[model samples]
Target: MGKKSATVVLAHGAWADTSSWGKVVVLLQSDGINAVTFRLPLTSLADDVTALDKVLALVDGPVVLVGHAYAGAVIAATHSAKVRALVYIAGLAPDQGETVADVFNRYEHDEKAPKLAPGDDGLMWLAPEAFGIAFAQHASPEEQKALAAKQLPISPAAITVPVERPLWKDVPAWYLLAQHDHMIPEKTQRFMAERMNAHISAYPVDHLPSVTAPELVATVIVDAVRFVDG
Candidate 1:
């Protein structure tokens, strides 16, 4: 990809901040693809999308939005005309009238996956131990620890709210399926990808491929960028 190609804006999922995309950003930068990441307020879907819209407004050219986990829904809700393509990495793509919780709870839960509920704080928190187990089992123990420590609690309102017309319906999209993901089951990923008819790339990775397998994540995003900017 060229330096002036469609810039990639990586969006972090629930329980994560912008740092999750650091490694992927570095890899994309090495390829002369301008990749940037922004923080999503986990307060609510509207809040997160507004934050992403503000960031999208700052960029100067076409964009390929890459979202992981819950950010998938956040990215697809954008009204930005500059977004040409979308890349969903182990993401949750809830259709119009469907909430993130709808997609998440549609399939049977993996035994290792942590059961989630809003805590007394009114935000959903992933247990630190669950991070090493289901969130990123493929990641190194040290990496898992860091991920757990760096998470931002996602508000219950974020996932329970229904999304508007998803941009994926209008834009070309790509999906990276994490085959071994315990958090969001592989079947669900496949269902969402096929529903969107997105170009699919499957890997024997976990949910947090941006952290555990940055190279793989970056490759799929670069593919989207090439297609959109070609």
Candidate 2:
């Protein structure tokens, strides 16, 4: 077998903590791959970017920066030259001039998602009831409850703030489109992937495939590593 490849630093989505990637991390490590998950502060976009930057700096060699869900904006906004590739997993890959809010507004999605209202602390989060349907439909009931308990509230200001620099434009990109995702419509994902000119793969899964379908997610990530190596 070829030598073990570069380290992978995986970032989680809006409501999730680094534990969201638990299964994927286990699978990657079983193969002797070096991987780490960044525990994003889920505060402001700038703070999230800073956390990812710290993770990138810790990588010993070339790195494949992986982002899930909202973290696509996070990774693209704060990448370093040491990153060899990017893999967006059922995530939003916005451009430098675009904001996650702009991307969401452009797409006409079902409004079933719980209305997000800003909190006293200026952070926004999913309504407790919306968690089961919108965010954890694919996970087991226990998993859903666990995720709900640990969900982090983010600042609403972070959503509309466009990325200052999107790595998608500067680095090679791979997108894993979750076909069964109810949160991010497949149609919108296609549009974003096309706009970004990414190499795309389709998966018949929900938004958190890295949690519910770890093996499949790991394979997609491994494929991206191979593509970058070539």
Best by lDDT: 1
Q: lDDT value for candidate 2?
A: 0.82
Window of ten residues with lowest summed lDDT in model 2: 105-114
lDDT per prediction? 0.92, 0.82
What is the per-residue lDDT of model 2 for residues 63-104, given as tens digits with 9 covering 90 to 100? 888998888888888748888788888888777778887776
Superposition TM-score, candidate 2 onto the true structure:
0.93
Query: For model 1, how does the per-residue alpha-carbon lDDT over 143-200 read when each residue is reduced to its tens digit?
Result: 8888899999999899988888999999999999999999999999999999999999
Clashing pairs in 2: none
Q: Estimated TM-score per prediction? A: 0.97, 0.93
Model 1: CA > 4 A from native: 1-4
